[model samples]
Target: MSILVFVEQRDARVRSIVREVLGEASRLAAVLGGPVVGVCPAASDPGLATLGDAGAERVLLAAHEAFARYDAAGYTLAVVAAIEAVKPQVVLFGASAMGRDLAPRVAARLGVGLATDCTALAADGGRLTATRPVFAGKAIQKLAFPRVPALASLRPKVFAPAAASGRTATVEPLTVGFDPAAARAKVVRMAAAAGARVDLTEADVIVSGGRGLQDAGNFRLIEELAEALGAAVGASRAVVDAGWRPHSEQVGQTGKTVSPKLYVAVGISGAIQHLAGMSSSRCIVAINKDPEAPIFKVADYGVVGRFEEVVPALIEAVKQLNAQV
Candidate 1:
């Protein structure tokens, strides 16, 4: 038995989340007693030998022309084929945009239970349990799998990537019978966002603003702070709804969930919906005029002041620190 990880790729390169999944799967495999395997669907080989350092004992490459772009039907077939071939004890997928789409498809196709957005996993007595946030992050739930080959999708950036061990995994080719007609939908083209910053989900550090900024034009303060800290810019739902920020930068229950190493909240009132997305960050720094703002409750550090004054001082401090380094 083995733990199988669905290795996602882009532009013929492996995604960072795959390494995190593989690392976590390796840890679980140690407790569950098995090897960790990677199942990758790509148009071409992504040179995955380095994954061995991240604890992939072996990688199954499911290469096909249909895999050039993420066709839901084709990817579902590839993952199903890999599962059938490997007969893994557990299957892990990153809870990213692609994984969120693909995981449920595979689960429905195989008629198995699926857990999405899992933040933690544990193995006991050769059994696996998954932990996830529920009720808009107000409660936590632990789930157990009654069936074998437990399926789960892990939240990105929640788990630490495995340290390199100078080991190499053996890559093997896996063939899947893909039918063109089965693909009901196809991605003809993708338009990238103009001047896109770091993906919020994958960013190590994030600086977010909310309605407390007073006006849309004031977002420049948030951007300057993010730039100074080399972090991604995020916005509260109120800001997005007000058109002060794009929906892509929104972080909350209705927006994107982020678990960055450091999360800076400026002028955000910390609505429950907003806290749902970012409460898991390793370090949270909140700056708000109201000392009683809900955001301060979860923040590791709280600064009570208006953003207009607090933000500029913080940005200057960051710049001076960067200069010193």
Candidate 2:
């Protein structure tokens, strides 16, 4: 009943979401009377050792020339091979761009059920229970899977990383066969957006503006507040479509999903599509002149006022808070 966690690498380092997945996998594995194992592609990835420290009993390195760049087919093959070798009872992956595309393929190949964008996972009475939002974040549904090697792709930041275990794992290198060129889609190049402050999914704090901002330059106020709190600046689809912000900075069903510790929504009316993406955030703060804005329905705190007046005050408050800290 061992658990297998797919650890992701970004810029040769482990992505922050990997640690959260480790914590979740460890808890589930402990309950199932199995050890948690971490799997990652090997190619001078500095994240392997860190995965072990996060609580994996062993770190399985899948090193092959094909894995240097992410070939969904190649990675799928490698994960399938690793699962066959380890015989894990449950598999976990962060529901990121890679995981969303990769996990389903592996699950389909294995002929197993897979839960995507799961907010919570648990092993109860010898079955895996997956909890996720449904009906556009208006409700939550819990499902149980009976098949062995249950697969799940978890939402980032929903689970917190546990304290470091300091346990060194037996690193096993996996050997598999796959052709990168055979993949239908090949990653040729990656271009980082200039002056992007945060990776939306990984940000602990997010300050987002919406149609209420009225214009793009108004986003600078959101950025200033984010900077003061060491947070990330985000925008709703309306703002992005209006060219008030970059699409990469948009957080909604049509864009990137995020579950930050603290989420500040400015001028957003809380459309269902927008809520679907960030409803899982730990704390939600809404600032809109319209008290009737739908966002306040789910907001933990609400400041009903015009953004031009409210945002500056919030920024000043955050600056003072930082000074005190």
Which predicted model would earn the best TM-score? 1
How many pairs collide in each candidate, listed in order?
A: 0, 0
TM-score of every model versus the real structure: 0.96, 0.92
- Residue range 33-127, candidate 1, lDDT tens digits: 88898988899889888899999999999999778778788888889988998899999999988999999999888888888999999998888
Backbone clash total for model 2 is 0
Top candidate, metric lDDT:
1
Task: Give the poorly placed runs of model 2, Cα more than 4 Å off.
Answer: 45-47, 181-184, 193-196
The CA lDDT at 40 in model 1 is: 88
lDDT digits (tens) for residues 78-174 of candidate 2:
8898899889999999988889999999999999999998989987887899998766465788987767789999988788786798877778888
Against the true structure, candidate 1 reaches a TM-score of 0.96
Residue 191 displacement in candidate 1 (angstroms): 1.1
